[model samples]
Target chain A: MLGYTLRRILQMIPVLLGATFIIYALTFLMPGDPIAALTGERPLPEATVAQIRQAYHLDDPFFVQYGNYILGVFRGDFGIDFFGRPVLDLILERLPVTFALAVTAWGLKLVIGLVIGVYGGLRAGKAADHFALVFTVLFMGIPGFVIALGGQTYFGVHLGWVDPAGIRAGWPMAFILPALVMALEAAAGLARLTRTSLVDVLRAEYLRTAKAKGLSPQRIIWGHALRNAMIPVVTYLGLSLAGMLGGAVIIEAIFNLPGIGGLMVASINNKEGTVVVGIATLLVLVYLVFNLLVDLTYGLIDPRVRI
Target chain B: MTQLLEVRDLRVQFSTAQGTATAINGVNLSLEHGQSLGILGESGSGKSVTARTIMGLLDMPPAKINGGEILLEGEDLLTATAKRRRQLTGPVMSMVFQDALSALNPVHPVGRQIGELYRVHRGYSRKAAKAAAIEMMDRVRIPAAASRVNDYPHQFSGGMRQRIVIAMALALDPQLLIADEPTTALDVTVQAQILELLKEQQAENNMGLILITHDISVVREVTDQVAVMYAGRIVEQGPTAHVLGDPRHPYTLGLSQSVANEDLKGRRLPAIEGSPPDLLALPRGCSFANRCPLADEQCSSSAPPLESVGAGRTSACFHSGKVASNVAYSN
Candidate 1:
């Protein structure tokens, strides 16, 4: 197991390098010069532009610039944005809000998805199951931005159940509504996946053996069936965790939450390449880590899974 | 004493997209305590269904017991409340399935699965259950039961897994053990060992055993009495020796003749002609008529009733005498 973990960690190096290169390349390829855009209609003098560009190594070829950036990253340097604030510090400040938002959304999806899934799976073809089917389809069909904007209007504006916009209230109060909207699509997909996986597990021959062993329905379903069913669901959940963290940009923008997502969007618009690359790198790290954790969790849930 | 189990006119039907198929039609069976009965049949012969129905493991709606009385120790299981039936499952009766790999829950440790019976039925503490699990494992002759207890079902070999399944079924010392093709998935050499283990356990517990199998040799080796089923109905039933030695039903005779033997080496073994009838659209007469060599016009016109042919023997055929003479001449 230790050897496996070491190997997996080693494998992440190439993936991280690849992801960083892609983000850096995309940032480098963005239309409009950051230096020229900074001056904004009042073009910077040629000498000042040269000085700034030289200091940042902006005139270097793409691969050379990427190599320099990677070296800086290895030494814990993410460079400064156009506003002179360290990109790492900028991301760190907003990291908590995004982390909290993503986690809240994740928790919401896990709970809602499992409840609906287990309920529907056990009572398949019944009214509740049909309702779950329709509910999942409805949520899955609508785009996330639509749900966010619609939810913001109905609940935040008309119903007056929440603040219409912004995170001035802070913490849970500000995060809940947008997180819920963010959770819906994933929760629906998860419910469908969980339902199908659970239904398949319930029909497995082991469940019959469990029943024939004289286990109660509750024990049989929860004990014998749920763990096996959860194997696939856990993989989905882990992938979605990475997705929620990176994909919360629209939700954060709609709710005006000062999270990394909103920061990324603002930085992208302002042509702050450093901030965008920094946040993308963090997301890549998070994706790799969560995937590893999911693999580890498999061994815990199923004894047959060695690692 | 009341028979260990009694099934009187038990009928099971399955509703499918195609149609309602009578899987077990007018089947009757009885077993005395400590005796072994082999229910011999091919795939879709409803032998497995009969075992599952008796165990109360059949899924309703798709499967329905149209009419039957499954009596366990003189108490009709058909009329028993769900809760009562559940109560009887572990202590009164239990079942071992065909494929041990699929039958044993893969995620759980083998010990916990076997221990579950004690934990749920006997109210044993987790530690006590673990200890009991090891004990059960040892009884099944799994090597190093203590160490292997923590291993999952997939960790064990096919034969070892079946033993674990048998251990779980016998955990509470149920009066009856229904082994549904328990050795079917095992290696040829391992098959004999599993059968031997089952027989040993049955004798030690004095448990009524229903060994369901398609293998004639397995039946002859393990069971005292044998019932031959065709198209969901029992066509011949008697002492295993008598039934296998002198089959009264043509279907039974065909089944016996099909078995490969030393004498039949290098010769084309005579196989029963035609497949079993489609249950969804069964003919009004004997379901096996199409496949039976001795099938006459009368055999196709009317279904034969199960009737006494000899001491403790019953044959469902209009020409049992003819079949017996044929068997005698062949021998």
Candidate 2:
């Protein structure tokens, strides 16, 4: 099992490299120069432009630039942006903000989704199952941006329960609305996945055996059914967490939050390519780490899962 | 001996898209203390349904027990509270499934799964149950029971898994052990070993055994009496020695013929002509008329009740005596 996971971890390197390489390549496709965007329309001398270009290595081949970026990522050295701010340092600072939001949202999503999903699944073919279906559908149907906006509009802006632009202060109460919006959207899909998985698990012969042995429905679900059902849910959660970056972008945009996703957007808009690339690389690493954590979580759940 | 279980006129039905499906119709049987009764039937003959109804495990809406009196030691099991019935499942009665490999929780340890009855019913502490589970595993003759107790269901072989299920069933020493094809999942060699273990356990516990299966040889090996079910009802029932040695119902006779014994090898095996009647679209009266050789206009219009035919035997047939009365049905 150790060997298998070691091989799996080793295999992750190229996949991540390839993904980042493609993303970086796509960034090069975007029009306009970072230095020009930073220091607009003021015509600089060709030599001064060359000096700026050389510093950022615009003269280097795309492959050579990619190689240098990969090496810099390895050494934890993301160079300065056009604004002359340390790209790595800024990203490291902003990362905790995103981490806090994502973690809260993830926690909410997992707890609510699992509880409601397993509940609906156990009460399958009943009113509860129907209700869960409708509820999840309603939540999932709306776009994340819309949910975030509605949350900010009603809960944050009018009622004054929380701030509309999210917490400049790292307070827990500020987390409630944005985290809830993210959670609501995530929970819809996660709940559906959990419900379907749990429903299948409930129908498994082992569950029937448990029932026939006279276990109460609650005991059966919590004891026997939930553990097995959560396997698929775990897989979905891993993928969802990997995709969490994309969601964060929209969420950060909505709440005007300072997170990796928020930083990504700001850097892109301000032509801060180094910070953007650095954040993208970090996102890839987080995705890889999240996947590994999920693997280990699954191993913990099922002892048959060695190591 | 005192009666442990009495199932009378138990009719189970389902109102499907294809009309009403009579999964089990007017099936009657009984078990006395420490005695064994085996029900043999092909698939779809409602053997498992009868067992499920007894356990009250059938999901509502689709499955409804239209009429029945499932008396366990003179108390009506059908009318018993769900809680009471559930209470009795582990304490007074228990069932072992056909596919032992699938019948257990795959993720949990086999010992813990088996020990749940003790934990749930007897209030055995986790540590105590763990120890008891290892002991139970040892009783079932599982090798290295103590160490292997933590192993998952997939870790064990099919026969060993069946033994584990048996261990679970026997853990509480329930009065009745309803083994639904207990050895069906096992090989022939393992099958024999399981049968021996079951018989030994049943005798020691003085538990009434209801071994449900399609194989005549398996029933004959483990059970004292045999009931032959056809088209959701019992056509004949009596002592296994006489019923299997000399079957009364044509279905039972046909079943006995197909047993591939030395005496029947050369004989052109008389297979049942058609599949068991579509329970949803069952004909007006006797469900077996289409396949029964002795069927007439009267036989087609009316279903026969189980009437006393001979010494210790009952056959549900219009012409029970006119046929092979020499085929004795005695225990």
Candidate 3:
């Protein structure tokens, strides 16, 4: 197991490197002149323009810039933002907001997914299964941004319950709408996945043997079936976590929430190349880390999954 | 005589794309305490379904038992509540399935799984359960019982896993054990070992065992009574020795003759012609009528109910009323 894990970590290095390259190249091609954005147009001199270009290494060839950035990664120097702030510091500041939103959404999805999945799986072909089917259809039929809109109109505007337009002081009200939207998106897929996995696992011969041995339905489920069914959910959840931050961008925009997502949009609109790159890099890192955690969880859930 | 288990008019139907199909139809059987009953038939003969129905483990939506009475020690299992039915399983009754590899959970320790009967139903603490598991492992004669207790199901061979299942079944010393083709996946030697272990466990606990299998020779060594199933009903049933010694049902006689018993060598093996009928489109007559040598016009129009042929034997055939070995009828 240890050897398998070490090998997996080694295997991920190239994947991470490849992802970073794509992000770097894609950002460069996005048609933004960071030098022009940073140095204002009024009475700007040619020498100052060249200096601005040199400062951010935009004057260098594309391959050279890529090579230098890859090398700079090892030295912990991701260069400076358009406003001259350190990229790392900028990323660290926005990290908590995105983390809080994604984590809360992920947690809610896990709880709701497991409950619906197990219930539908246990009483398969019954009302629970039908209810789960309908619930999943309702959420999956709509996109995250749409649900965010509906939730704001119904719960925030019509009901006058929540501050639909903006994220407020405390963490509770701040995360409510964003988390709900993300969960609605996640729960739809998860409920369907849970139902399929639960049904399959419950029908396994081990479950029958457990039944033949007179173990209670509750014991069979909690002790054995649920653990096995969590495998696919783990993989799905990990991939979902990677995209969690991205999903909040539109919802955060509608809500006027000054979270990392809003910061990302503002940074892009302002042509803050360093901030955009920094946030993108942070997302890539989150993706890698969550993938690793999922691998570890697979081992915990079933010994057969070595890595 | 106190019957340990009785299954009367048990019919299991399945709603399929074709229509409602009866898998087991009006099957009647009885077994006494401390006795072993062997149910032999080819695949899809409804043997496993019968055993599953008796255990109350059949998933109900697609599988519906139209009518039946599964009386286990005078308790009607057919209408029993889920809780009551569960209570009758494990220590009271258990089953060993055909495929051992798939039967045990791959991720859990075999011993811990075996000990779970005590842990879940009996409420034994983890440590106590572990100890009891080791003891049960030893009783089943698993080598290095203490050391191997923590080994997962995949670590054991096919035969050994079946023994673990048997040990698990008898751990709580249930009154009845239903073994559905327990030796089907095993080699000759291991099959013998498993059968011996099961027989030992049954005798030691005074338990009644219903062994379901497609192979008749495997059950000859241990079972006291034998029931032959065709399509979805018992065609013949009697004391194993009497039935094997002087077979009555044409299907039963043909089945035993087809097998290469020691004395029946040096002759062309009498193979039954044609395949088993599909339950969905089964004929209205005796299910075995097409394959029977004694089949006639009367056999094709209507099905025959199980009728007495001897003092303690019954067969579902119209003409075979007397135990005449010379009676010959062939299609």
What is each candidate's fraction of native interface contacts (fnat)? 0.90, 0.78, 0.73
Considering summed lDDT, which 10 consecutive residues are worst modelled in model 1 chain B?
A: B322-331
- Report every candidate's CA lDDT: 0.91, 0.84, 0.83
lDDT of 2 by residue, B72-102 (tens): 9988988888888889987899899999988
Q: How many residue pairs clash per model?
A: 0, 0, 3
Candidate 1 on B168-223: residue-level lDDT in tens? Answer: 99999999999999998988999999999999999988999999999999999999
The C-alpha interface RMSD of every prediction is 0.9, 1.1, 1.1
**Which pairs clash (backbone N, Cα, C closer than 3 Å) in model 1?**
none
Against the true structure, candidate 1 reaches a TM-score of: 0.98
Query: Which parts of model 2 are misplaced by more than 4 Å?
Result: B263-268, B325-331
Clashing pairs for predicted structure model 3, backbone only: B293-B329, B293-B330, B294-B329
The candidate with the higher TM-score, 1 or 3, is: 1
Model 3 / residue B199 / CA error / Å? 1.7
Name the candidate that leads on lDDT. 1
Model 3's alpha-carbon lDDT is: 0.83
Ranking by DockQ: 1, 2, 3
A1-307: candidate 2 lDDT, tens digit per residue: 7787788799888988998898788777667787778777697888999998998898899999989988887787877777678888898887777777887888889888887897888788899999999999999999888888887889777998788886664657777678888999899989998989988887799888998778877788789988899888888888787676657777877887888787888778877767777888778788887888788677777777757
Rank order by lDDT, top first?
1, 2, 3
lDDT per residue for candidate 3 within B1-331, as digits (tens), equals 5678999899999999989878998999998899999998988899999999998789887899999899988889988898899888987788989888888887888988988988878899999999999999889899899999988887888878888888888888888999999998999999988988888888988899999998888768889999999898999899988887777788877777778756757766668888888899889998888877778998999998888888789888886744346444332
